[model samples]
Target: MLTPSVEALIQHLADGKFHSGKKLADTLQTSRTTVWKSVQSLQALGLEIQAVKGRGYRLTHPWERLNAEQITASIQVPEACPPPVVEVHDCLNSTNAHLLRTASLRPAASICLAEMQTAGRGRLGRNWVSPFGANIYLSLLWRFRRGESLGGLSLAVGVETVRVLRTLGLADLRLKWPNDILWQERKLGGILIEAITESQGQCVVVVGLGLNLRLPPGAADAIDQPWVDIRTILGGGSSRSDLAVPSRNRMAGDLSSRLLALLNAYGSEGLTPWLEDWRRWNCVLGRRVTVDEIGQRYEATAVNVTEEGSLVLRRDDGRRRLLAAGDVRLRVRHDA
Candidate 1:
């Protein structure tokens, strides 16, 4: 957790430029010693701070902290729908957990974004790697009417994400089963959904997303699986490679708008409308794959996903299986 003073210091240094301790202290209305202490705390949070005797201090890499005003302005809400209430945090254990814990108090159509997550989570209890200013960590809270089924909600979210990325000029993006976005067999983002039913029969769901923007070398070392970030994908051709404030604000706003639109459509039409779009982005369809479910593993050829978003797998013995949940891994075929 970052104290107010530490967060202030980080904001002052967010431009990735050198700032004298005295100047920062003056701007923050604090002493130089306090600024130094805050800098030390930020370093503990995995930030690389470069301090020089005469040149002052600057972050090793560029970073633009999320701005609530910019993000809200970026989203284009329909006239009939109320705009989502957006909250930006300096740090949090997890955006989804926070929203879920406060589901009762928060209104429907709320979104939370954190610059850094101390305990980010993925599906099936996996640890999501989230480094400060290097990824997008966000959660959206939505309420569904009684008896409404959220069967293909995650897949729908993936489709919307792909749509937004494609609009931003990313090609060849694909969707993995359940809730993962991939680029050339490398993970680019993931989704996690948590839902609770209220006494009135309304279900509140928190849709969490973590998308890699630019992973620092040190942060990349912690990830066990192959991964890709937007910076690498853009190949220095786009301004997003710099991770500037304006670029981040634009990307965040674009994503939020697309996701909100998708949720609105899903509420009205369910997943049926998104089934064809999901197939367009499906990467594993017709590919040999391995699925691990409840401590058991099975190898099969990936077929198509059902309209309800369940994966269909065809085994060697001509058995077709429907898997509602599991961890899927693309298999390398020796024969190929």
Candidate 2:
């Protein structure tokens, strides 16, 4: 359960800086033995702690909370839309779920950020592993007029997210159709868009995003898919580029600024503006993939993706595209 003392201990070690045992004990108002026990509990949770005989203990990497002031300062908003206030929580069942319940009362671009999530979710009800202070878990509320075509909104969100990631010096990135952000064909992050249509031509959409920044060894054991994080991409020295992942606050701020700009444009322009980007980053196009839909499964070569968000497949029998809004799983094996 990570009692308050343990959480307090974490705040002290968050910046990748070592705190001596004596200092930690004094700060937490506990004895050295109790502080050591608390550190063990955190290690038990799969967080890597580097303890030296002389230097003390620190996290494997720096972790930062979602800072509201830093986020708003970095966001460049249009004159019409003020920077949405961020609701930062230490933990929540799901940022998306919480915003869905309250989006009706909030204006567009309202953001929800969390340090950790208990029941974080991805598309099609898969659990999104959310270890504390290790990744990005954000939900933003956007509304559209009832008649607006929501056809490619989810994919467009992916495009916007990838745009932000690219600006952050991420390379070899790809966008899987629907809502996945991929780096070298491995899942890096995802976008989930939930919509509620009212009786009076109003629609409320909650867009949730989860990106791995610094996942610990055992924290993501439940994830069935091959996942990659920002540190894994750049920090691993696999890439020759000098890119580095920014602090959590800056990452959140960059993502928020770009995504909000997207909501403002996507509502009116539809997917026309993002089609060019889709062609550049889509990993599904010209790739062999298996599609599972409603108990039927088939393999096909993806030929195209329409602006309406249809997946065009070239099968041995004939060419077809899926346009229905339902459970669609594209099992794409990485060969390219």
Candidate 3:
């Protein structure tokens, strides 16, 4: 949680320049001791604050805070969809939870972004690691007057997200079945979709996304699976060394705009148009894998994904099964 004083201090130091404690205190109308304590708190939030006796304090690396204005400006609303309402927060428990709670009051294309999440979540109730100002934690609300099945919404979202990232020059990205983005078999990001239908046949959907821009060391320690961030990918190799890494604000704007465009396209055409794209990016297609469903594990050959985004598996006995939901894992040769 960021206090008002800390928020004020961050604004003053956001330029990546040194500001004396006395100067900050004077500007914020607080005591120097308070300024000192606030700086400590900022450092605790994974921000590298360099404190020198002569230079005072400044963020070690450039930190770009999320700007609602910049995000709004970057969005291009189509004639069929309403202009999005963008909101940025210093901290939130969960952006999806917030939108779900207030879905009835908000219109379509409503978006919420957070710098830090206290209770960030992923599919199947997994804890999403979110450090302050280090990654993208966003949720957007879309409404439909006539209810739609939304059977393949998550896969469509993944396809759009991959397209946006690839446009930004990140390579070797792939999509995992259901709701995951991967780079070289390691998780890079994920999508979570929540929906509720009203009695009148209107449905409201909340699409939540978490992408790792620069995961702090401590935050990465909590993740059980192998994962990678955009920074490491862009910073590696001769080919990508010249690529310019985008600021968080810019990335947010790009992602939001692309996602809105995707929503509009999906509304018109459904998941059929995106099925080929999803198949092209499917990382585990044709691999021997196991799907854990309700305490039973089904090991089979992944044949292909259905148009509705269900996994089509070929069992040992020449039987084919279409699974809607399960935890999927690649089966090694030793396991067979």
Please give, for residues 1-336, the per-residue lDDT of candidate 3 as tens digits: 688999998888888789988888889999989999999999888777889997788986567889999889887777677889999998999999999998878888999999999899998889999889889999999876575557788899999899889988888898888889999878899999988896667788889999998787878998998898887788874445323457778778878887888787776577887889999998767778876776777788888887777888898899998877545444423243
Global lDDT scores for all candidate models: 0.84, 0.83, 0.84
Flag the better candidate by TM-score, 1 or 2. Answer: 2
Candidate 1 on 181-257: residue-level lDDT in tens? Answer: 99988999999989999888899989999998878778889898889888788765465556522266777888888
In model 2, what is the error at residue 119, expressed in angstroms?
Answer: 1.1
Model 1 CA RMSD to the hidden true structure, in angstroms: 2.7
lDDT of candidate 2 over 1-336, digit per residue (tens): 568889899889987788999999999999889888988988876678999998899987666767777887888776566458788887899999999887667888889998789999999998999987789999999878888887788788888888888877788899988789988768999888888986666899888999998787788677888898888787775452213666788888888887888888877798889888987998888888888888999888888878787778888688676634468888775663
How many clashes in each candidate?
Answer: 0, 0, 0
Residue clash pairs of candidate 2:
none
Error of 3 at 84 (Å): 0.9
lDDT of model 3 at position 238: 44
Supply the global lDDT for candidate 3: 0.84
lDDT measured at residue 140 in model 1 versus the true structure, 0 to 100: 93
lDDT of 1: 0.84
TM for every model, in the order presented, reads 0.90, 0.91, 0.91
Kindly report which residue pairs in candidate 3 clash with one another: none
